[model samples]
Target: MPTELRPLGVTCNIQCHYCYQNAQREAGNMGGNYDISKMLQTVDQVGMEFTLFGGEPLLLPLEDLERIWAWGKERFGKNSVQTNGTLITKEHIDLFKKYNVTVGISIDGDGELNDVRWCGNLEKTRTATSKTMSNIELLCESGIYPGIIVTLHRFNASKSRLPRLLLWLECLDELELKSCRVHLLEVETPMQRQLLALTADENIQSLLELYRLERELHHLKFDIFQEMRALLLGLDNKTTCIWNACDPMTTRAVQGVEGDGTMSNCGRVNKDGVDFSKASEQGYERYIGLYYASQEKNGCNGCRFFLMCKGQCPGTAIDNDWRNRSEQCSIWMRLFEEIESDLITQGYNPLSQHAVRAILERYLVQEWTKGANPNLLRLFLHSSATSYEREVMHAYLVENNISHKWSQGKLAHLDHHWEGE
Candidate 1:
């Protein structure tokens, strides 16, 4: 659902005391006013292919991102952004290698473990995190491979600052920088949750030690434990957005757009910024009243991640109340019961397995109260599951031995999305 645009809305340069758009940039809502032909006609009437997000979308100008990446590389061939790599220059890495831009940045680990990214003090937050670790090592030595995020806090996941944030993620995996994303620090108050939060047992031990250094990394991949082992092996991994089923008033995994082009939700629930752009469709009526309210009323009753974490990410819900569930739901239920017991001790069957997770959690509580982001390998890939739910998911993948490999096509290239790490 990538469609960011946002000309300057929570406009930033540095002020990350755990910024979830800092109450819509302290209620004045930072910069604004746009029309570059209504932001390229809201990506040609939301036919979706956009990104250049912000609170710092390189604080716009470099000929306004060279006419927004030359009209997004002539209508979306290759272009994207999402920076905080403190105003990357050298002409913004030559307009991000001319347009094959993909870049993401937002660092939280490196010198001083990036001091809560607050640059109004502490020596301008270590000189803007040493110019964002030298523009993530010159945008990965100019080949331009960015995509790092790293938010977990307490000066970067403490326990002695998480072994220097895993030695700066092994120097961003020696700058080959495959992927990074970790973020659990969404704090925003009580002095950035007592100076940057991270204790649901230090957010499940810094995401189980970044999933045991992502099983001894070869080339840095932590889009949170490879998108939780690609959703417990159902794959189609859409690289983060809090394990799909987010809808803090219709977030639909980071949509934004505005500066004249309108359409917003997902300024991290705009806290109290007042329906930043409320286009209704009853965002799944609080995911059907928290799927039948019971966990002392914060519900997701008997949850085995209720069809891949639906009760999560309403911008860390709970007291922030996007109908409450994730105040980091006990560090994502202890990393989804430790990757569902390491994918059932490597034999697999973890679509949260109880006869295919009680028929996909009663058909995803009526397919997400009608908004639908449902797709567990498209329910055995055909008649969308109704030959008695594909005969109980092919008898629970033949009495649990499991790998039918999505009916032998070997997962025909699973492509779906959610967002974030």
Candidate 2:
């Protein structure tokens, strides 16, 4: 849960057609309009890993940018920035080296493949991308290899187009670019009508192909594979945040600073022009109840991936209806199925009944209940788990001397009993 500082908020120079923040940015609502000194103080108070983000963070004044970099370097050993790479200059490259910043530049592909990332129009997009590639080359030549961030859409995610994109990535010889974060387009209300948005099926297709390509290219990494590989290898600690039951209300680890020095629930929480920080303050308690209620309502009863997926990203929950799982549910399910198959081939039983119980015990019983009182055993256990599976869980509990009383077809009064066991 890294802190993201959006100095300019949604006010970017280029308008990527599929951007979720377009509505806010189009309304001329730049976020960093708050008291800079207060914001800096807040940054110092919560000194940890900082991610400098923006409509475009580099669009901020060089002095302001330098202040942030200096603060991060002094407090934390390293920092990172996510930029479109259009505004980068030679001086900025030097500053990156000085602060040991990990630069993340957004680029879908070469020339025509990046048409959706527009700067006024197609011609401007071409020009901007050209300059972006040149800047990336310069970063690599200067021994600062920036990680590429590609937003997957119909424009660049086609089976035909992805190969070309991979080829180009490989051509960047001196670039020690290890990984790229592939963002499936965030299809919010405004982006629904955009032609660039990929359908759920298309999204699955693209990722399936990407996984195949990922296996071939050992040198270049994709973060999704990294997570999956970690999970498959039983190195769950290295898995991504997606695997964790990250309660947004409680954890709220993804903090965003509004332009007015107020804190937000992250950049995507509000897009209807309401100040998210203020809104969150007013309704945080209500939100906590709402989220928990949603989880109970949905009741991960039949979902085999409940432990690892935990209803997936709350940000993409259907219409922000936390009651439903993420809109990307189907895509993620398909990917997980593939990964599970691979893990089984390698002699790992990722989907074993024992594994499922472990997920429920750790994520649900421990994290949610804190071992004070046991709850949600009925909701956590998939209805599809065979009787043998139940026996396995019961036997394991008995062997470990964990006390529990079964009530109303649900396990209750669970406690670790060591005195009389």
Best candidate, lDDT: 1
Q: Which ten residues in a row have the lowest lDDT in candidate 1?
A: 411-420
Score residue 213 of candidate 1 by CA lDDT: 84
lDDT of 2 at 93: 90
- Write candidate 1's Cα lDDT for 49-159 as tens digits: 788887887777789888888888888778888888877988989888888788888888877888878889899889888988898898878888788888888777789
User: What is the TM-score of candidate 1?
Assistant: 0.32
Tens-digit lDDT string for candidate 2 (1-421): 5677876667789988877676576666656564667666667666658788877889888787788888788888888998999999998998899898989899898788888888998889999999999999899889888888888887787666767766776664236677787777777764454677777888888888778876666456778866654443333444455554444443355667655555666544444645444333221222223234444454444555555565665556666654456767778778878887876676555532344445444444343443221223333343444456556555645544445676565455455322211
**Every model's TM-score:** 0.32, 0.79
Tell me the lDDT of candidate 2.
Answer: 0.65
lDDT of 2 at 164: 74
After superposition, candidate 2 runs with Cα above 4 Å error: 26-28, 172-174, 190-194, 231-235, 248-251, 278-300, 352-366, 369-421
Cα error of candidate 2 at position 117, Å: 1.3
